[model samples]
Target: MKYTTDDVHNRVKKILYGLTGITLADNKDIMISNRIDKLKRDSKYKGDIMDLLHLVEEGSYVTEFINSFTTNKTHFFREDFHFLDLKNRAIPQLAKSGNKINMYCSASSTGEEPYSMAMTLLEVQDEIGKKLNASVIATDIDTNVLQYAANGVYRYSKSSKEFPEWIKPSKYFKRRIEKNLAGEEILIKVKDELKKMLTFQVMNLNDNTYPFSKNQFDIVFCRNVLIYFSAEDQNKILKKLFSHLKIGGTLYLGHSENPQDLVNYVKRVGQNIFIKEKEAF
Candidate 1:
């Protein structure tokens, strides 16, 4: 069946909102078209956009549709200061308390953020001459990205700009030359030591309740992805994240995000950083 741009936009918007709680504004028409068109060409989808939408409704191509539209822009140490704070402040405080550092990296797109966290934790552990038992639970709504994160392989050339400068990549990642259907490409895969510090899983922030118990995580990194959500949804998710964090735990948000709604529960400690208030329940 023939589909107009409006038809495609409305259909895709519904599918995305239903599945991921991400609302595509009217201005995103071109982006939606480009992504869907790319999906058609790359996946060799024979059907029209409407047919693809029908398939998505039936849960046949849901993952592909979500992966195609959902933005997964991430890099190692994307916000360098957060990692710096983790090393210089957070880890030191946790080390002094002698408690295992439990961190959750929500929206860990393809592993860069979590790996950066793991590396910083390792560095702090070495610096303090103490064995800091640090573990990061990385999760994303996109299953495909989670799988990529689990594999712990990334395109080194593309990631060069955002790669952390303090730690040598060679120390935590081994260079590998691999041949694919396209051609030869240089890739960097995370070493076993860094991989051991992370546990990647598939999770949706829109879920009514997360699987984790209350006060489980000492730190939560729910960065970048919150801007895509509606204000009400953002508040809901933030409250849920707050519940998972320990009273004195830290929550790291994207630089552009505001934590005004959470003022009573968390105190702004730094730019885009909020610490759960000691008296907050």
Candidate 2:
């Protein structure tokens, strides 16, 4: 059962695109086959990749396909400047209005980015000596990652990569050494205070409309995920994200992403950062 045939690969690609609107490049054929192989082993589906694709097309094991295909590579404060800007510039200006600030981490993979947002807001609150009433909604299409995010635990070794050298992990996380059946391992967990600020949910960004109310978010972090989409889909998602943002709200994109079609609606303020025009509404 060779699943690397062009016909089988195209079938799998069509199934993925239909479900998630992600366009797979031809070079990704081997990558897709590898993911499907893992899925085959995990699900114990004693069949070839074509069988898996048929099951996916029949709406069976769809969630597993999505969880397997969607990329979830992220770390806390992966982009340092974004958090700095949020803490020093965005929070301060928004705080001056004395209103609750709403934020959406649109692709909160494994909880790092959303937790980073919480930490930044908490730091600002301590500096101002007042509650910012900041609330964060973290959403991702991958339910498996969402569950891991909700648990808020990670290997200390890996989690250590979350912050920049200047920031200390102890400031935001509580570290503990615990012995398991395997061995003694150090684990880092998100502090309860920071965990309280985030609400995690499963969401598909490919939807025509998001579940959020209009003009709801002050900041939307849809970083790193747009590169997987086509230009038309990227513009479509950007337009939808704009509609969800409040006037003068900010949008953060991945470093490699540029909102070519969205410049009319949002003014670029920083590298891969844009502010919704006050007149956008």
Could you say which candidate leads in TM-score?
2
Candidate 2, pairs of clashing residues: none
TM-scores for all candidates: the values are 0.92, 0.93
Q: Residues 65-108, candidate 1: write the lDDT tens digits.
A: 87888899998899899998888888788889888899999999
Candidate 2 lDDT, tens digit per residue, 1-281? 44447888788778888898888999997798788776786667886677777888999888888888888999888888999888888888899999999999998989989988888888888888988888999999989999999999877775467676645679778899999998989888887888888999998889989999999999999999999999999988888888889988889999988876778878888878889885343
Tell me the spans in candidate 1 whose CA falls farther than 4 Å from its real position: 1-3, 41-44, 158-161, 177-185, 278-281
Report lDDT (Cα) of residue 252, candidate 2: 91
Q: Which ten residues in a row have the lowest lDDT in candidate 1?
A: 157-166
Error of 1 at 241 (Å): 0.8
- Candidate number with greatest lDDT: 1
